[model samples]
Target chain A: MPLFSLKKNNVHQTGSGITPIVFSHGFGCDQNMWRFVAPAFEKDFKTVLFDHVGAGGSDLSAYDSVKYGSLDGYADDVVEMGRELDWREVIFVGHSVSAMIGVLASQRAPGMFSKLVLVGPSPRYIDDEGYFGGFTAQQIEELLEGLADNHMGWSAAMAPAIMGNPDRPELAAELTNSFCRTDPAIARAFARTTFMSDNRADLPNVVADTLILQCADDIIASERVGEYVREHIPGSRIVYLKASGHCPNLSAPDEVVRAIRSFV
Target chain B: MKSSGPSVPLSDGGEPNAPAEDLEDLYENAPCGYFSLSSEGLIVKVNQTFCRWTGFSKDELVGRRLRDLLNVGGRIFYETHFAPLLRMQGFFNEVALDVMTAAGEKLPVLANASERRAQNGDVLFTRVTIFPAAERRRYERELADARAAADARNRDLTERWVAEREQGELREQFIAVLGHDLRNPLAAIDAGVRLVLREQPGERIATVARLIQGSTLRMSGLINNLLDFARGRLGGGMAVQLDVSKPLKPTLQQAIDEIRAVVPERVLQMHLEVDVPVAVDHARIAQLFSNLLGNAITHGDPLEPVNVDVATRAGQLTISVANSGPPISPAAMETLFQPFYRGEGKASQQGLGLGLYIASEIAKAHGGRIDVVSHANETCFTFVMPIV
Candidate 1:
């Protein structure tokens, strides 16, 4: 379970009570990621914001290896936030790993949330039996071992690959500095949880109105994985933004927010 | 010596005190080291040749193990790599290892070791050879340096070849574009003449025929200018000269008038600034003037005037053609005098990109140089030739 709270006054509005929205941040990040989209929707909807365990402004004591072992733990946290807020009808928008957790949590609370918008979520990270995920076991092993070896270096290397895309080439430096400021311990733990976790089996159970905004890119998620997500989720829709890299929120923020706003 | 003799005796088998064969002839004088080690690796015997080879007295090394002579790193390598390879091969040949002598000096040497077994198949001793590698090391360094120098020279030659190839291709591309400058208008003339001959045959047609004749002649002159460029490059050191015995005034006037014919109705003002009759190639001088004149007309702003000037000083004939023009970039100025070089993509001027190229070539052929100084709104092209 994650330790976090949605500061009530911090939740401004841009939308009516049609469906109150919750912004769940991706791995290694906090609710501060919704700075751009939150204001755009704050006046109309009751927006709920929170941080995951082992992340920004969250309770460090609540973090446990067993509960947070699978992404299902994060799913429980998002669902609990909806219940606490009394949001009967909710649109849960997530970025990166939180996007997959959103799918799992929405699957759990089928009647609680009306829609799930997954931004840059990759399921089944490793290639199995007869598939290729670009990353070999050696690479995954190196990622885990290297992160443990030097968390700060790993984050520095990875942040640019995710953010410095051709479409939004400027985001890389911002993300590099932002991720560098993150505490190394929390980032390492989060890195282990993000890259090493496999979320393929959870996709089929997601019945919420799912909208996956996968940036047309090479680094973060490939078109194959995006298609895999769309294929697995029964009625999920995918929109491939003509952009590159993993974190299009910082790169293609307007395009991402627009897809969510219009999709609902 | 010891009292015991060989148990497997000679054919006579008698207890005869036959003089023992000289041990020197038997082993000490051999080129390689010969030694016998006990089963526990204690050296029982070694030859004088081995002692001399290792700079050790026989007494110092005869009872010592072979590993003592090897460097620590060499010992590790021998045990790990050499021993394993030797075990598989039975008789190791030329296994290279480093050795530290009694003086503690490192020597690179190749050794061949073999197990000397008895008839009963029990291990007896190992035989080895150590050859000095100083000469081989010297030879290797010499070879490497030579190879490196040769590789560098080859690389430089390859770069020069590529530059020349690209230059040739640039020339071809320029000529192909110049074919448009020399031929496009000529083709228009050809078509015009054919139409006049077939449809409009009369005195009016004669005027059209005259225009065609004029274009054909201009194209012929452009072709001659191109040929002069080829001559400059291909002729290397040898060149044809215009006899200085011919008067300079007449030659300058001929050049000015010829250029005037090309750019008709354009006001060309000239000054015969030379006091003494300067010696120069008449046609070649005119070729230079024509290039400068054409460049001024093409690149100079249409509203601005073209001025021609001539001056002589200290056995040098200086011809200056000044024009009003926009500033040429440093990059363009750097390459402006290069033969057949058009200034970037915008140099689609009427001349066969060879005008300036041939002009420079002509100046070089006559032991002279052409230089240009241009700034915003003004440009002056000067040709300096040594008085023949």
Candidate 2:
């Protein structure tokens, strides 16, 4: 109700730039994923990081199933946090599902963001005719069932594949730990909302200058999906990273940071 | 043995070449498989034992990621869980996964992996050990089957319990119907006895008629109590049909007269003061008064008169019956209104013990109550019902 709490919301603010850069982590992760990249901008820009309602150290009581059934609900939280911060021309950097959330938020309050940085974002996850969203409906349903039956085992199995750094198991371990710490029911709901959402229509409504960061060999968000996002959003730029996984922030943080710095 | 030229050869084992061959054979035929992967997860080297266990040639395994040898589910686990654990902790042990053989059949296995890092802190290689776990997989499947069986048993038990409860309800309904059906035949017999007594003139025949009439009335009381008890217990509760046209005082008088005929020796003093015509269940109120007066006639001191008073004040109809009698015990008074609770003393030694219970239930069905006060020389029962 107070926009956010320092302890419950786990909100941290740093840096000296007049316009702040807000980083929202995707599903299966927390603000800690930005550990390597966030510090890079601390010297020049005001950087903000907070865990979503049912993730990390944030207040789990803030999570409502009905309210958070869609990405628009999450977008409302971002807009509310912005209003509370009273910042103008802020840069919003969201990864995976949070990218669509930021898009929805900026559309609602057009003046809230000056630029958008969407890393490995997908507007839709299930494939339709003429569009390749990577997964089939049945596959997504299996994923949901898998998450329900063996949430802990699913976390252990999926964290590494999603992280995509089989060489450095530590990165996968970090992702698994992050996934395990999240509330499973909220995670399931968030997963459904994220993967089932079709926000390509909302992209045309976004007025922010967007940067779509595409990983070369991401299994989650393919290059075509990233191109789809870029083409829909007016004047949005697409930058392909040399990193080969879904999470360049953890695998190739230096590249991710340089890309953000150059665009912002 | 102590020859000076070859004393050094005697120090070595007699068959030194046997040890070299044994070491090579052990590497190729160990109980568990062993392999090594580069930092990129590409299988750089695999022992003969590992290739034989996985049904793959060394050529097929080399240059392929370890995950490629696993089934779809196991591949996901290897990439997601096993890889991360090895990277962070430098080793992971006892991970259960399925390996895909060259024949495409799956073999469940337990595996362990440890990371080898270069001097520069970069990953160099990963060493892995694998063991077959067919027995463990079978045990897990058995546990799942047992759980499913237990769930089915619980569901069966729940359904049976519901069916038994429904059967119990049907039995109660049958008892209620049996009690109700006995009433019409009993009334017909009462009317025939009355007709016989009116036509007969001889003193002995008249006495027989009176005996039959008394017995019939007692039987009627027992049957009525049974009907009310069954209705209250089985069919929710006793139902009262209020007749607004009936005069309250005359109804009370009729019940008093009926009780007096049974105990002709006991004198009954009746006082009725009612100016208002009240709405009440005529038959039930008559039954209520009869039960109270009969209880007084049976228990009251034979010498003392049983007094019956009926009055209407404001919106309340009050009926009180009082008689001089031995005081009821405290324990007897506690269970006085419970059905079929026959007492041990004078009041308990008679009747089926459902009279007062039916009376109380009737009063309740009319949204009223009956109260009792018994002390030395006085036992009083009061019935009160709201008319407006």
Candidate 3:
């Protein structure tokens, strides 16, 4: 199938700008994660929302392990989506792991994207010597083991912490629902790909104007990780949000919108 | 209070007007845990029953979210599924979760929540009821283990069955090799008999040589049938090497003459007319013709002539064997060409019952077909091959 149909790409044109802002979700969820944030840019930009292969309403048969083993595969999908849709001046908005995917895509097709907005971006999730990427290899292994044994249990336990709204249980509930709806095998494969990936070297190759939105108390992607991303990418700016979780798009959509609006 | 089985009576002496303080006591001491959360999921109010169930004080539980009382997994479930469902559908029911106490002990529970809406249609708060469900969760774990055990057993049984079938196939192929090896010894024995008969022994000794020769021929036929059956079953059907350069009529006639030598008492008739060279496997055709002729002689009436017909027309070669006999029953005809199928007949009149099956398989290997027609007056088996 064509990339547009295979990816379940949905286009909503409401703005006058020649550039289209495309929203790509991270590993654990789908395009629905951008429900609150994508609409904020509809009036000023041509907004695009799509599920990656094997997530949401995408063609699950299109997901081949070899094709999606690395961040490069997802980057290729973004570039192919542009070519299939005949789209230009693309403004890519990527969340979590998708931020590095966008960077890789922009490097491959530099003239395709005009700007990039990265939300809770993490180039390397595993911590190494002299660098703190928030998680240790052992911790991620435990997380993966928990997922393998009882995915529902893992989702229930981690969604609230990830959402950072223990006072408002609805936010945590939304995250868990998203996690449960995904295919378990695909979710496991994507989790390994997202957490194990190290895209630090590819960050300097990005030519697009990039905005990194970092949350205040994101345990998944720490403040140090955000700073690492900003330092590596040339001519990029970082805006810190008061929202105290990983998914500011769901927890605090207003702050995420404000950050993107000021940069664009 | 006098008649109510040692229970205390109402303070107002059966009056409908109970004090608000008394009603508050009933609400706090309810049998199950009861709590309410604001639309934002903050714990607006919780009864004493709920506080005691979770082993937390009122001060610690009141302002916190209901999800905060549960364990990590329960908190995730509350936030992801429970909260979203309450907001969207206005109610959620009987969701299983584990509540963690102050000392980190788990209490399994099933919770039901309903949204409280104001007149303006906005959600004011959510009321949740919790019930213990330890026994049900334990039962579910047992059921899961049982299913896993059954699946493992099924896999083991399937592997054993496959291994047994492979061993059986190896045994059958071994028998086929054994039958093939016996052929050389039998041929040697037949040659020795012929040489001794050439010496012109006395009449009494000559009779023994003739009987030995007859037994050897019969044994050889049985071995050939066994070998063919085994080859067909083990080596993916009978292997036929086609030699298009060979003439079909002469090859078939030669096979007919050999069958005539075997059954000299049966009157044989042949009508061979072939104007063109037909492409075929000559040795396999000879085997097929020999099997068909042998079948007709064994089953046909000795008083009637067994007919052999071969003709080539319109790029097709048709060979048929017809003999007079009782019409084959529908029951017998269905399995007539199947291997090891012996219909009701005299035991003395039986061969291996593999002759027709081998003939059919050989025909198929040459991309040809065999058809049989049985009637009161005649039974005919016809082989049709395209002259490619």
Best by lDDT: 2
Rank the candidate models, highest TM-score first. 3, 2, 1
* Best candidate according to TM-score: 3
lDDT of 2 by residue, A78-185 (tens): 887888888578999998889999999998887889899999989998899998998788767755543443333334433434344444444554444454256657
The top-ranked prediction according to DockQ is 3
For A113-189, candidate 1 gives per-residue lDDT tens digits of 88888877788566777654545555456444433323222233333233322332334444433432345555556
User: Tens digit of lDDT per residue, candidate 3, span A156-233?
Assistant: 433333343233444445444553355656776877888899998998888899999998866678899999999999
Number of the candidate with higher TM-score, 1 or 2: 2
Please give the CA lDDT of all the candidate structures.
Answer: 0.65, 0.77, 0.76
- List TM-scores for all candidates, in order: 0.36, 0.56, 0.60
lDDT of 3 by residue, B40-73 (tens): 6678777788888878887788777676676543
If you superpose only chain B onto the true chain B, what TM-score does each candidate give? Answer: 0.55, 0.58, 0.66
Model 1 error, position B211 (Å): 4.4
lDDT tens readout by residue for model 1, B70-137: 65434423432344333222345555455667777766565666656666544566666666665664
TM-score computed on alpha carbons, candidate 1? 0.36
Which prediction has more favorable DockQ, 1 or 2?
2
| Clashing residue pairs found in predicted model 2 | A160-B80, A161-B80, A169-B84, A169-B87, B343-B348
Please give, for residues B310-378, the per-residue lDDT of candidate 2 as tens digits: 888979989999989798899999999998878565554488788999999989988899999989989
Q: How accurate is chain B of model 1, given as a TM-score from 0 to 1? A: 0.55
Error of 2 at B126 (Å): 3.7
lDDT of 1 at A132: 48
